[model samples]
Target: MDLIEVLQHRYTAKAYNPDRRLPEEIVAQLMAALRFSPSSVNAQPWHFIVAGDEAGKARVAKGAAGPFAYNAPKILNASHVVLLCARTTLPPEHLQAVLDQEQADGRFAGEEAREGQRKTRAGYVALHEQAGDLGMWTQKQAYIALGFLLLAAGTLGVDATPMEGFDAEALDGAFGLTDKGLAPAVIVALGYHSDADFNAKLPKSRLADSVVFSRA
Candidate 1:
């Protein structure tokens, strides 16, 4: 299907068929889509924890307990659950690491270009840091990756539900994310929707273009 059709038909899956599993190849494609997601200054300030087994899914479901109980079954029964994490901090070492990888990937022409890239990216990072919104900036990048993952899943004929209903603190503790300078940003459930998924039958809704857009 075309991009427009995918956008028109894809809905947030409320329930999933536990008996169904996505093909391994499709999972790989989704992983790649996440890895290549665009972020400002190419910060890539995110990590994804993917749970594809019963034990793994149970662990991820910890975040969905208590007041977030409504979302528990979605994580437990889906073929896979992904906990999208954002870096809690962006240290100089992390920026250097990104620059090193870019150089290794032939992204620079020479030392001059490499240093230039480093300065440019660091300037943006510093700007956000000084504004006391560095953490928020990184989480925004993680959401960008989330959007890419959802779109990729739709194109691959897989169902996806991007959820923010989980408890971030609980999930961070469950995965030791805080110790690793990471924080849970969102959770996504992936699989085929089950018969109980009422959302599958609903028509997509959106505000009209006139209300949402204007000529500048």
Candidate 2:
């Protein structure tokens, strides 16, 4: 596949055809792609909540009410919606969990490698904690996963809209995310674009290459 062609074809879909739904097999792969997205120090301090059913989507749509009402219909009409959340605090148990998963997945060569990995990750976590930036740092990492998912969706020929137009606290409450130590960072609505989506036909706009790229 021509990567540039895929990129050219992708855009922020304004509306989705509610009649269309992502196939379960494709959805499964997208989930896996999100799971494998990169994160700082392999902390992986994020949680992805998938909403494919009508009821579930409606619940998520609640966050878009009030000041965020403009986003409600997109959330409801999309075939699937994913809530990207970041850990409120990366406590010891959380870091340990990452280490444990790494070990279980045979990511370590031996005890020395495992210990080294743990120490490096711990130091970074400690730095963030000391600076009172743990939450912000984790939220930044969550966006990296968001970027990965967007590109992956484009490659898979799925239309996607990355959104930050909802009330984070409301979303957290609706999904009981804060109780799980996660805070809503962003949302993505995925599906096929509607035939009436005028944005699809508009030319893509970007800064001139010289203004965006530089060589040292």
List pairs with backbone clashes in candidate 1.
Answer: none
The candidate scoring highest on lDDT is: 1
**Clash pairs for candidate 2:** none
TM per candidate: 0.98, 0.97
Off by over 4 Å in 2: none
- Report, for every candidate in turn, its global Cα lDDT versus the true structure: 0.93, 0.92
Residue-level lDDT of model 1, residues 56-169, one tens digit each, is 999999999889999999999999989999998888899989998998899998999998989999999889989999899999999999999999999999999988998877
Deviation from native of the Cα of residue 74 in model 2, angstroms: 0.7
Could you tell me which 10 consecutive residues in candidate 1 have the lowest summed lDDT?
A: 165-174
lDDT of 2 by residue, 5-108 (tens): 88888899989899999999889888988999999999999999999999989988989989889889889999999999999888889889999999999999
